[model samples]
Target chain A: MNLERLGRTAPAVPLLVLGLVCLIFPLLVLLHISLQVRGGYGLGNFIDVFSSGVDRAALGNSLQFALWQAGLCVVLGTPIALALVRLKGRARGVVMSFINVASSFGGPGLAFAFMLLIGTTGVLTTIWSQLFGQAEFPSLGSMIGLNAIMLYVHLPLYLMLSLPSYALLRNEWREAARMSGAGFWRFWRQVGLPTLAPFALGNGLQIFMWSMGAYAIPYVVTTSPASIDLISIEIGRDLESSVFGVERAATLSVILMLLAIAMMWIYRTLQRRGERIL
Target chain B: MSAQTVAPLASTGTTTSNDEADSFLGRWGALILLIGFLGIPLLALLVFSVATAWSGTVLPSGYTAEHWIGALTSSDVLSAVGRSLFLAVAVCVINWILVIPAAYVSVVVEPRIRPWFQALAVVPFALPWIVIAAGMQLTVKEIAPGLFGTVGLLVLTLSGVTFPYLYWAVENSLITNNAKQLSEAARMSGASLPRTLLQVIVPAIRTGVMSGSLLTAASVFGEFPITMTLIGGGYETLPLWTLRMFSGRVPGAGAELAAVSFATFALLFAVSLLITRIDTATKPADPVRPPARIS
Candidate 1:
């Protein structure tokens, strides 16, 4: 029986090994490069990354981008998610599929969609300047512009993560809260909010993960990356540009991965607490 | 997800009349607002793809098929499309062969390690595209310099990034079809593990596998970053070409770019239909969301 069980599992080993070589080992190589310094391995690269003005600025911008994205999605997505939960059968089906498809779209298609809608001489731009007599449409190359495009991807991603939690919200709970003389906001504050708080945080972390890790939209959107540098941009520059070694890119990548791991750790803590409350 | 998970967000009968109005608006309002927010851009792209000129108007001033013809017939566009298609198809096929057995083993044979399989899929997701690209350059390319800046590398790297989607899709299908019990039955009837999986489990889960493959294909179809950073000067996938067009490299080809964008969307929409059809038709017990215990 043990031999038979081993035979069944054998097919998976090659795939797993391929996954490691293709995905994990390369990452491990980056981690190794990230630690290497002049004449030996140490924290010298990390120190250089921390102290350099440009590197520091890029990391700061990435963190701000991530935090703002998380906050915006949670704030905007809650009402939207709640609204979605209330839809009748047919409408729910339509919107669910729309959200799912929206998440898959990134890179150039999304960039062009944004450009066609909001870029200078774009449809909305052309229309708005005409209607409102405002010639200055929002720039797609600015930090705000970049993040807005980031939301194009991150918002749908957050919805996909958080929408499932709304199923836990029931009409009965609200009805009970009202019967206990609690008003709407009060009920949510006392009960509804608590029930959903962990998930909201979980969803926020998920948004933070994608938002922080995001590269494609930002890469395409920003015209002057120098003024609005993201860590991924820096990493890309170092990887491709001869002025900077691959070490810098590897170091920054490690830092970015660490930030994501930090979020995962926090999520793990929240899940433990959440399991009890839930 | 199950239908009941969408049990309406009802206003209690006791709540004020104002509450009903709020929810009524909120429900339909959300759907319409999202549709308009997301959909108008799509609509505009469609119109622009055929437009002759619309410098400062609410809509296109004129329409023609010239841009569509030019964009579709361009040698650059054709090569990029070929590369993109090859990458998409290859990634989907590679992941298909790899994920099925791995998912079966982790989710069925040894259920305790299911989360590990899931975590593997998600970790790559949380890495920035540049990091993945850099890792590929530093390791994979160095190992085989021949593969550098090739669509072949994109195929291998993308399978790394996208297998998670297929994993979740197929795993959900497997669970929904009760693969463990079905496999046990097949085994008792003298079928080997490979035979049981190939004959019984796969046929049952093909819907998931098909949609999942198509989903990954659509993702690869529009993929940027890795393709651009690694292979930009040496190669030109559809995305790099599109970006070049958008950046005004091609000069007065807005209509062509719009046509290309619209064409891309049409393919994505077509694939989406298959994915959502399964979601709505079979009503999988879980939607496409990532499972719990991770961000």
Candidate 2:
């Protein structure tokens, strides 16, 4: 029972050491790469990420994209989550499965799938053309199309994050409110909306953090002049580009990691508050 | 209580009736919204997969088995599926091996360190995929040269990136399981820590392990960036094969694409059902007992 006594003889120490070593390798290697320069220590790469106009633009665009995607995910995802809790029977299972399966459908897969739906020769576009007599169908590469696809891609995660809170509401309570001459809006105002607030906030933070690191979805969806640059894309480019040093790529990566950490801290804080409120 | 007050009672009935109608409408409205959100995209994928020629039309010209046939017959496509499946299973195994022990230590050994360990394990979630891919590639190429461009690399990278899915499941089970009781009981009966773990703790959390494995499998199966960067060219997974087929409009490309999507979709659905079943099976076991004292 007292494993701590065996801690001296236990193999757990060695195993823990190995696990820690494995975990730190990637982070340390990347940091080492970031600090390495042309045979000496230098802050050149970090400077480039901050000072360069193009790098600045890419970072700005990525943040903007992340913001839009996060906002859209909440708008589209919350209603479906609400529906799942309120709706009953076999229908709920199917809907929940759809949300889960489709949520696992990544950016590239969904992008191409949507291309078949909304491309120039796509079914929806052709219909729009026939109805409106517009010869040219809009590209699926448009910002609206990209964001819409990403929103759907993220639906499952937000739904899961919100479901527990939604489940806290008792059906008997709703029925009682109805019996007492209370209507749906009256019940919702007094009960449902208030309970859902913390869930919405916590889930919204997760969605935001997820969208900020998003690369694959945007990469596969768009090829417009407006789309060629983002921090992730730039890092990939710099990694491959002989002209740019690896340190610059590393610096950009570090910046991305910091941004992600900040977002996660915000998310964790909100989650803690939600847990407390519950 | 006069005739004027009685006048308000008549309006109350009208408003109540309207409220009933509005509530009915809202419920249906909510249902329709959810249906569209989940259904439209899925239906789109299904239709696209079967479409013979979907050119500039609201619908495809016709449906065919051509793509499905092509996908099944192609050796390359078949191989990609095989590779993906193998890697996913490996990812599942590796994740469970590390996650179970790490989680056990966190849960049974020292509850004080549990939160810190959990936070560290899930750090992968917030980290960028591209960064992970890059780090994985460098690590594999330098530290484990033979692993680069192989299924092993995929298993390792994916396990690291997705282990949190398993850790979450295992931790939830451990906390709710009163693992202390089970292990204590086993130890009292002369079971060693490892045996107690293998026989008692592991079985108790089997559902969690299954769910986590399913989740990690699904993730590894669909993963692209890590597979692409770390494995490099030549050894393409299903997604990479699809990507190549996409870039180069090969003869069987459409069918290959459809096949891959449908296969992945089917796999995901199956895994999700499996997880749902596990959760439901475990549901009754829980709420039967309260949380154990933190001793």
Highest DockQ: give the candidate number. 1
Worst lDDT run of 10 residues, candidate 2 chain B, spans B286-295
> Candidate 2, after superposition: displacement of residue B113 in Å?
3.5
- Give each model's whole-structure lDDT: 0.75, 0.67
Lowest lDDT 10-residue stretch of candidate 1 chain A: A218-227
Candidate 2 lDDT, A1-278, residue by residue in tens? 46664572342343244335445567667777776767787776787678999989878877777778677667766666666777676666666666677776774556667776677776676777788887554455455666667776676677766777677667666656655666667777887676667668767766766665666666555557645367776766565442675667677777877777787787778666655655
Q: Across residues A68-100, which tens digit of lDDT does each residue of candidate 1 receive? A: 999988988887888777777765666766676
Q: For residues B1-295, what per-residue lDDT tens digits would candidate 2 score against the true structure?
A: 0111122334443434555576557667876876676566567767767878765667778998777777778898788888888888887877766778777877776666566556566557767777766665656655777876776656666766776777778878987888888888998999987898899999998888887777777777777666666664567777777777765457647545755676677777777776777777776333211100000
On a 0 to 100 scale, what is the lDDT of residue A14 in model 2? Answer: 36
CAPRI tier for the interface of model 2: acceptable
TM-score of each: 0.91, 0.86
DockQ of every model listed? Answer: 0.47, 0.38
Among all windows of 10 consecutive residues in model 2 chain A, the one with the lowest summed lDDT is A8-17
